[model samples]
Target: MGNLCAGASPATDETIASADPVERALAIAKRDLAKGAGKWQELYSYDRSKLLGSGAYAQVVKATRKGTQKSYATKIIKKGQYDKSVVIKEIAISNILSEHPNCTKLIEVYEDKANYYLVMELVSGGMMFDRIVKKGHYSEKEAAEAMAVLLSFVSFMHAKGIIDRDLKPDNILLSDDTDSAIIKIIDFGTGEFMKEGQTLSAGIGTAQYMAPEVFKGKYDQRADIWSLGVIMYILLVGFMPFGGKNDAAIEKAVLRGKYALEGEEWDEVSDEAKDMVRSMLQSDPDKRATLQQLQAHPWFAAAASASESAAKGTRMVSRLRGFLASTRLKRLAMLVVASNFKAEEVDQLRELFVTADTNKNNLVDFNELRTALSKLGRAVDETELRRLFDAADMDGSGELDYREFVAALVGQDVVERCTTARHGAFKDMDADGDGYLTPEEVLKMMPPGSTLEEAQEMVKAADKDGDGRLDLNELEILLKN
Candidate 1:
């Protein structure tokens, strides 16, 4: 559901032709969903009493999985209230995006006769709007950081032929209360997958954020870009771009494509920021900034400090060399340890991941990593580069997903953090608890269909004592190495 377009209602204005914008938008997204089907067979459970957010059909609540300290959010969908078809697609999308640092990670899905529950990574920070107003000042750098997350999300989804169909501040949440909280984009209620050259002819999104073309019901992914423009405007100006007494008035104002950009509120924002916002809010979809143009915009580019990049790149490359040199088992152990890193610590690493994912596929291929490294002046020999790439490609997926990237970014503090967290992971994986872990014990944690031999390979990589099993000390070494 990539298209986030305008208004909750259709315009009754003499100038408008469409009678229902929201319905038109939902029809496009649901029509797309009708073409695909899926079922979530995994079992999941959560406490339904601690509600985080709720609506007519579903309620999200805080949840805790047995034997783990991780906090999660579970969206419980009431039976007979919403179509099962929509539920399937939402779960499928969650599974697809579980690895992205910016998107919610769907942990499990289960259903009972009365409801369906989708448990996922919990976002603890308040809404983006609530945070800004409470903080009382929205800095340009902070706005840029948020924009970067949204742009990356949109770009990644577009690369996969998916449309968010609904992109607004309400659907975007933060991972925590800290200033560096990671962006967690949630709610794919109106998402759809599009083919090349496809167009959605309905405006299916919140009233104020909808693009003008969305109101006319003839638009593409760019409508989400427009919605982001609305968020950006509010971030800098301290008010919505198109304000009105009601949904109808907001719809009319959005259709007019007029917003304040020269008042006192706009005085502190950079011209480049204003330019990007203006381009995104363009009434003519064709006149809007292309995704490539948006990614390359000077507003975002200026946020990157060349000096900082060079310094960080130097340290990261050195870490890469060490990571590549470590045993395969250590690398595998680091993946589990990566999950144990506090969300705030991971948020600090996110900027590096986003910058390296130049193509925005939520992946950093060998070439992309090389190019990114070179750009940061941390170039290395081709042979060594291949070694590092091969080392970080944990699933042999030929690329480093975000978790793998985080594992490979180990420095002293990261190592200490992982060392402290390694015990819980070891105890969990050592299911038999004989004071040693066998390949059989670890296989439960591997991907589905992982072979006995693959698990053996992992254990052998760090079997320094020459035994076929590992003790907690070995697990610590495996994670810390």
Candidate 2:
């Protein structure tokens, strides 16, 4: 058998010459194994000289093991400073992933008098988020390869009944060299361990990437798949699929299950890649792609081959630079430029602009754009405003209409759903066979347990004309809310 231990250490240049490849490989791994303190006091037990960074509740310090002098990152979390349960959950998840090659290894975890310390592999390179921002967007091959690694780790976790609630670009850390990075799914404070036939009802995770089911308080491991979809979208398009004018708007959009992909922005991306993203981002959790399904995607297969070949090459810089300059990279760059914007607030502005434009024009006038931007905490000057319009107005029409606006704000599917829901809810609530719903009729449609006061409030809110009845426009607004 070929020597399995051939490339076990950074220092070693020779392949294992032993007759027993498996035994030799095991011995090689054991020899290179550098364990650190798995508990809290391991902080003082090592050199506390190198302080790397600090966060709201934890501080990461670069430390060396006493006996082996192996480098490690010691994350110290104060006992009362953060949620103890959350800290423990993160530790548990890290421990479970410790043995996976694609995962960040947790050396050890321990507790001292007032703090908990988690010793983990020290990834010298920074976060994938930082890399993407600096590099704009990655080549298809690079993005696919990185995604495959992450999917592998996530697949392993799912098989073990652990769901990584937090899946974002920031959580993925690179090694000393950028060529090989580990998808460190850190910050498992919101992670859930679900057994067969079990489900959870917790609305946790970042707002922009959260699924509709998450807001409805009905979620499971499939929630992770939704998050993966958002991540993949960002990886390809360099922006999120759902976001609205303000927090309320974003919440509404999410709750209503609005988001999609169509038009010129996605034209260059491969059909396989688009399919993979759509599969993951499905509004229904049951329809979202599972980890195994993702692994079998054509995109992953292509990426895996490229990654394996890249790993064997000696000139990493040249190889990566060539990949970055390829046609695929150029196409991805176009997508990135097409989707560039701040975040949720921009998403909201796009929504409002799309709504006000009404017609399918490519440019929104100053008045309409301002109205949208105002709802999202931004008031812009004419020049700055023009720049914003130019960024999203892909067709150069000098004014934006519904299709262009929706395309700029959220994906197409979301816009369709929002339109449908707004109309559907209004139709459903109009129960008296009249053209509209009166305050009394609206109250009657309320579920049995819904309080009388709550129903009255809904009527009051929906009665735009102050006549105790809701017209179609007023009813649509109420349903959106």
Q: Please report the candidate that would top TM-score against the real structure.
A: 1
Q: Per-residue lDDT of 184-226 in model 1, one digit per residue for the tens?
A: 8998768776777889986677888888887888778878888
Least accurate 10 contiguous residues by lDDT in model 1: 2-11
RMSD (CA, Å), each prediction: 19.3, 19.5
Off by over 4 Å in 1: 1-49, 67-70, 303-481
* TM-score against native, each model: 0.54, 0.53
lDDT, candidate 2, at 464: 69
Residue-pair clashes per candidate? 15, 18
